[model samples]
Target chain A: MKSILRLSVNGKPREDAVADNTLLIDYLRDALGLTGTKQGCDGGECGACTVLVDSRPRLACSTLAHSVAGSEIETIEGLSHAGNLSRLQRAFHEHLGTQCGFCTPGMIMAAEALLRSNPHPQRAQIKAALAGNLCRCTGYVKIIESVAAASATTELSA
Target chain B: MAALSDFRLLRPASAAEAVRLRGEYPASRFIAGGTDLLPNMRRGLVTADAVIDLGRIAELSELRVVDDRLHIGAGVTLATLAADPVARARLPALAQAAAAVAGPTHRAAATLGGNLCLDTRCMYYNQSEPWRDAIDNCMKIAGDTCRVATKSPRCWAAFSGDVAPALLVLGAEVQILGPQGMRNLPLSEFYRDDGMAWLSLAPGELLLSVRVPLADGWLSAYEKLQIRGAIDFPLTGVAVALRRTGDLIGELRIACTGVSSRPELIGGLDALAGKTLDDAALSGIDRQIRRGTQPMETTVISVAYRRRATPVLAKRLAKRLWAASA
Candidate 1:
């Protein structure tokens, strides 16, 4: 069975016929070619498939595409506006957050959702927000530093 | 990636419509959040010819206080519940338990109803089809003998949900809607000890909401032990809710999950009623909890570790509560 899915992905309107069993991750990566949203573990255990549904971080691998119709989805691919990297993305690059680069998209996406809601988050809040996104490399110190740095810069600019 | 079997998705807008769809598709399973159910289906642990999506039912996501009871809609996501000021103020244990669930992203999609109805998990039962096929499968999926205990005839898949134990301790009641009509039962009655048939709901019944009684003079705490800080199911989860009148205990409830086939309220705590929480009294209650709970070798951590740690955790929680009261 196929269902018509209407969603705003990365601020662009997308209407597609998705299978009944198609996961949000599969829809983003395979169907729409939004490969920036990585799929790791495929179960909800790892947040490698993290995406913003209605501006809240959700695991794409576990969410059914049909369930999230008419919602705005922000992904790692959408983080950059024009030719500029997002503040969080820049902080990640500056702090050496990406080691293997597999968990970067998800970590950044989760952090994006965090900073969207709480712009000036503390270090512990950043850790709690990125707790779902796991990075096997860097031992999470650099990733935490990256999110902290981004929050600090955002705090300063505001 | 494991492919889900071919199935028709049914999105029902209301509880009545959901019930009707469930009746029409008796073999179909309800999908909310799809965190636990979808993964199980992917692993071939569960399959359905039709999936009744409960996400579209807006009423199931309501969270409010009505008639002095906190009515938490079944579809209210774990993340929302954890961050809700009312939930933290009143049912703090439940809020903490919701936060203690698998990470931030899973909590965003995983609903309270989904967690309460989470599938009983066994290390042997949660593997991929090929992985289970290699082991000849366990009693939870296909094979007869219990993999946790070879001679046991029953499935020993442990109940790993973090929220159920907290709700059970809080004297919460579940509002269920079915073809027969709406009925409410204590959350304690909602669970069965059997792993395969863990929930006590009827075939077409859907959990609509959970009603948690106002914790007027009560202090509650929930502590979970897992291998990692995140993304892992609790090896042992302990939830305690109690009220004290000066030095004497008024009412007490101690509950635990990830220890047995079902999250259970440790009985005989009524024995501690009208008594002060001395070390001897606590040790006695701790011994009772340790004796009553039966942690099986069905999860990631060793059963020995879980068994030994349950009472220690309970005692520690009780001490913290006492300290707070003081």
Candidate 2:
């Protein structure tokens, strides 16, 4: 059975008639073409498929489309407006937080969620927040530094 | 779109609706975080006709502390528990277990209910069924006679649920809701100590809530021995909950996980009812802890290694408890 699912993805209200078993990642990748949410492991182990559902980063590959009805969705592509990189995105570039960038989208999205709520997070706090998103290339040091560097300025702003 | 077909999903708005839907579709299962379920499905260990998404059920996502008992709903995420100040301050062992489960992102989506219902794990058993068939199937999933315990009739796979020992030592109670209303009992009582029927929840019964008695003057600690400090399942895990009265130990509960078929609790702590946790007492406690564990050839860790490290963890836990109270 299929039902219509309505939600605002990346701040825009959208609706789609989804089948009973359609995953939210398929809706984002195949239907809406929001390919930024990578589907890695298709299970929840690798955070490569992470996307924000109601401001919390979740495994899009594992989340069903029908369950996200009426919730706010955010993807890595939505992090910036007017073609400008968000601060965390900029920090990733500055700190060399990417290698092949396979896990970049999920890592950045997870970091953005952390920075959104906690602008000034400690080193331990930053490490804790990004634990779900695994980065095989940078060994996590650059990723941690990117968040910490962003946090320094983020704290001063707030 | 002309009604897509991939995997069937149903979002039940309420608990009643979810249970009723579960009744209709015997092949359907509730989706809490999908960390465990989705992985098993992708690996083909589990194939479902339909999946009931439990996110819409508001009653399951609550965390309430009332009258010295903390009530945690099934939907409450590990991230929420790890980040909650009340949990850290009041239920330190649980918070430690929650923080250490998987990694941060998993802690965000993975719920208390999901962790509690984590599939019984083993390195040999977690592989694909086809992969198992190649090996003639281990005792856990497809075939009979535990290769882990080749002489054993029952599955020798581990009960590696991270929070089980933490909740067990804290005097936690599990709430089970079914068609007949609800029932609550000590969390330890919910275990069958058999890998096949690990959780005691009956058909159509949802593990609704966990009630942990508040520790006022009590000091607790949780320690896990794992290959990696982050994201790896514990080779052996320990949780210590104690109440010290002046120089005397008022009460104590020691529990361990990832060491047996279930969260193994070595009771009869009344012996240490008034004894102080000094160097001598800790050494004595370590000996008692060694007597408690009966490690087997299940998990990734060697039985000899886990058995050796069990008392070491007990000594560390004893010292931490001493310092926590100090």
Candidate 3:
């Protein structure tokens, strides 16, 4: 069945009519043309498809489009404004967070969520928050550094 | 490819409404989180026209304590159930089991109801129908003689719900609401010994909630015997609950999960009442568990390894319970 989902993406009201079985990842990439969110291990293993649903990081591939019908969703493409990247997004580039770029969107979204609730998180807390995400190529040394750097940067700005 | 995009999805308000809708569309499957259902649907393990999402059902999403029991709605996520203060304080076994299911992301999405009613899994049968047919099918899907037990008449698939064993020790009751109205029965009575027909639930019937009697003066814990620390299903999971007084065990309930099609409770093994958890006592319990289990070749891990680990799990669980009680 065709279901029209009305959701607040980033900071705007976005509505899309999708099939009942339309996966949220595909809906974001195809319907909305937001391909920044990479799809890896659509079975919800690798956190490559992670996106913020109501400020909580969730796997977009495993989530159905119909399920998120009156909820707020945030994708990587919408994380930035006009022509500038978010602080967390830039921190990844500076901290060597993105090696293959497959897990960047998810890593950034997870870090963004952590910093939203906690601008200054301990190293152990940051690691726990990113436990679900997998970065096989980098061994997660840089990703952890990226989140820590973002937290420190957020702390400095505050 | 064109999707099956013409079916209407109904959002029921309560268990009663869910039952009513089940009556209306007897073919529609009730969806709570869809962690299990969606994957099974993609594999064509279950076929359904409409997905009646129960996520919006307000009455089915709560975790409450009533009188002497902890009631967990079917829609309660594993993550929430693991962190529920009342459940954590009263029934630590259940909380521990919930925490060990899948992973953080999976726990956030997998619901307690779905975990309890998890589909019976066999290495061969859990695959796609086409994949099964390619091998001339196994006993669970098509062909007659059991591949695992060979001469056995029935299939030997494993029932592997991480939270079930803990709840079994807690002596929980299941609240199942269906087209025939609602009925609450002891959780132990919910399953049959048969693998293919593990659950006694009727088709279209939805498990609404699970109620566990609070552990009083007793301590419990769940131990998973798997390779990985986070995302691993135990080849043989054990839940042990023992109450001790002075130098004797007051009450002991040791159960096994994934050892059989349905979680098996050792009958005469409960004779551990007032028995001391000495080395000899532990050995006797291990012997009994070894004699009772005898896991077949059906699950992912080797049957020999699982069988060997069963007794080890029993002994370890006994020792842990004894130490905690002491």
- Give the candidate number with the greatest lDDT: 1
Which has the higher lDDT value, candidate number 1 or candidate number 3? 1
The DockQ values of the predictions, listed in order, are: 0.84, 0.54, 0.41
Ignoring the other chain, what TM-score does chain B have in each prediction? 0.98, 0.94, 0.93
**By lDDT, is 2 or 3 better?**
2
**Pairs of residues at least 3 apart in sequence or in different chains that clash in candidate 3:** A1-B5, A1-B6
Clashing pairs in 1: none
In the range B186-232, model 2's lDDT, one tens digit per residue, is: 89888877877888888888888899998688777788888865777
lDDT of residue B91 for candidate 2: 84
TM-scores of the models, in the order given? 0.98, 0.92, 0.92
Better of 1 and 3 by TM-score: 1
The parts of candidate 2 lying over 4 Å away from their true place are A152-158, B1-7, B278-280
What DockQ class does candidate 2 belong to? medium
For model 2 the local lDDT of residue B78 reads 91
The global Cα lDDT (0 to 1) of model 2 is 0.81
* Cα lDDT of model 3 by residue, B186-230, tens digit: 888898878789998997788989988885787888888876556
What's model 2's TM-score?
A: 0.92
